[model samples]
Target: MAGVLHRAALRTSRLLQCSKRPSRYHNGSLFFSTSSRRPLMALTGFTETQLTVRDAVSQVCSQFPNTYWQEHDENERDPTDFHATLAKDGWLGIALPEALGGSGLGISEATMMMQAIAESGAGMAGAQSIHANVYATQPLAKFGTAEQLESTIPNIISGRCRVCFGVTEPNSGLDTLRLATAASKQPDGSYRVTGQKIWITCAQVAAKMILLARTTPLEDVEKPSEGLSLFCIDLDRSKHSGLDMRRIKKMGGRAVDANEVFFDNYAIPADSLIGEEGQGFKIILHGMNAERCLLAGEALGLGYAALARATQYAQERTVFQRPIGMNQGIAHPLAEAYMRLEAAKLATYHAARLYDDGSVPAADVGVACNSAKYLAAEAAFAACERAVLTHGGMGYAVEYDVERYFRESLVPRIAPISREMILNYISEKVLGLPRSY
Candidate 1:
């Protein structure tokens, strides 16, 4: 198995020809090395760092093929081997700070890495296995104290501590500011949290959770966004009393577990809080945009993968002694899907670039990220649908793998944020229209 993985990794990595240029950091900014020849980069305009990340991540993902993901998805098991392989290769720390045992690369490189992973036939399930690690810790990395950075960041990057993001709740839905989860301060400066968090991914295996709860009561605070606090707290049910998790049987991406976590007066140390008190809504917003960008990349990759499969099938599957691809009716939709995927790819990468630049305005970043996510998810769904239609009967069969892709495509469309919400945001924020919802 090890030898197979090594050879496959090498074969996949050889597909991309990168320049010998290196990416370096100077004064907390990443500068990618440029090449004059620009091999395979004229179309995408990917820098050395981005291309290198894509190549390396594709190599890692190639080891776990479509069948590997299918089996895990069927059995409802986490792809820990795939996760550990990327972690061992230092891919998990692509967007983290260098001083904290990471490569200190920007979101552009991280987005490329995720796209490569999904494009390598792992689909959304594979991309989601380590998704939180890339974005959930952004707030901690930026606002954490010296002690928090020194102890927590290194351990997470090293894969010693796997963490899950806990923000969504059954009652709150998308109204995050109205979350009822409370973290009351105690005499010893510890917090006793009590509430329920639903749809938390990888909670079954994660050792820590980035939890957002109300530190000050809603009535006591002037703004709904205020009174909220974020915490990087222990999630061990065995170690901590009054904490319970019930695994949720989801529609797709079953490889990673989603749970409804219950915290009934679960006590956490005071040091677990991230950033300042009553500032969690602001801090988590940083991660929310990053998550949207990453999800967009994942959606783009899934679309591309599905399109590749459909195109290959169309060319090989013959009907009436001619390839199905020869028919304009069959060919045109695949071409359209390809175009959609390509367009979404551009939007996704553009959002990542805007996010990493740091000089761009927050409203601009929000627009780009939300638009990218909405476009990518819609495109991916269309591509997957077309791929399944192109396959006809085989599309419904799990053996063909398009069925799985089709099911998993819904993830990007409905998760982190919905298409309707994206439209609302663009309407209110971009058009300066009155609030609709």
Candidate 2:
């Protein structure tokens, strides 16, 4: 397995370098020289597999300019065309199984795809437009009935259907085991679900959902993690009798919509249930580690993008008739940003490898995932800050594009998981200290 992985990585690297070399026939330079050259070498030290994935994604993303992303963000519209293009090209299903109509690639490839998207100047807006569809179906893929998986996976892979995750709630926050949503089994063997979910990414546009609700009362269940059930249900907006979705306006990633979803006696077929009833929590937990690692990859990309932009601007912008990059004050921060991002990138790829191998224990992957996410988030934040400082007043301006990366960088630090929770995981899980929360 290790040999196979190594070979895969090497092949991917060769393909990446081949794909990314600029065409000599082009009339004009495709990108600013400094920023264009920086990402190639800066990210090359990571796994060849990751670099290959990044290069492929970057090649595809280069078609969409910064102006395209800015327009999408300004209009607060999802980049449906961009997403459909990816879906058509089979990029959206890069991590899914080949039998299920995906490219049959692994999470490592998917992370590189996302990272490259963000690094190409699309930022979170471009990435999140298709993020949920990339990996949110893991529960169904892994634990759903064969019939269920067959019915659902292909449509999602084809981009004919969209799914959103329903996990976080207003009351419970990150204490996922304490969620209050309830699903009662009726005489006809259907589930009547009633609950509210917050921060459901892309819910407003989703046609389906991977939902979790308590099937058995917490007190009645022996384990707190038991009694919770996972479901893959229809989010039929026209049948508004039971489901209500209120779009939440967010500070960044505006091109993709997030929402607060309320379910009141939403009727779903018993077959909609994923895996075993009362095992929903465990099923969902199966994907959380991968999600964190992927987010780290995304953060790593954003950090590299910011650092590349800052370094380029410093080289071109004049100060006292000299390039600002000539001074240590500006040069040192860019170097620091590079170091931090590289460190986080290493952790993210290591976590990805563990996940792909399945040899490491689950607890170990969880800790590593959290560590990657925390480090990547911090690194991305620092890089964006430095980018802003390096660009001076122009960074604050929208046309320069640094501010967009800066704002979008904050989402990864705050969402999916927070830095505080990541530290708590490390302190308790890695050090064997008492739980902090």
Which has the greatest lDDT? 1
Clashes of 2: 0
Q: How big is the positional error of residue 233 in model 1, measured in Å on the Cα after superposition?
A: 0.6
For candidate 2, write residues 218-321 as lDDT tens digits.
89988889999999998867666699999998788888898999999989999999988998888897778778877887887778777777876887899899
Off by over 4 Å in 2: 1-49
Residues 1-437, candidate 1: write the lDDT tens digits. 23223443565456543334442211100111131223211245777557656666765676886789889999999998888988887777888887777888888888887877777778888888889988999999998888988988878877777889999999999999999999999999999999999999999989889999999999999999999999999875875598999999987888999999999999899999999999999999999999999999898888877877777677779999999989999899988887887787788889999999999999999999999999999999998999899999999998778888899999999999889999999999999999998
**Residue 8 Cα positional deviation in candidate 2, in Å, after optimal superposition:** 14
RMSD of each: 7.0, 3.9
Positional deviation of residue 383's Cα in model 1 after best superposition, in angstroms: 0.4
Q: How many residue pairs of model 1 clash at the backbone?
A: 0
On a 0 to 1 TM-score scale, where does candidate 2 land against the true structure? 0.92
Worst 10-residue lDDT window for candidate 1 reads 24-33
TM-score of 1: 0.91
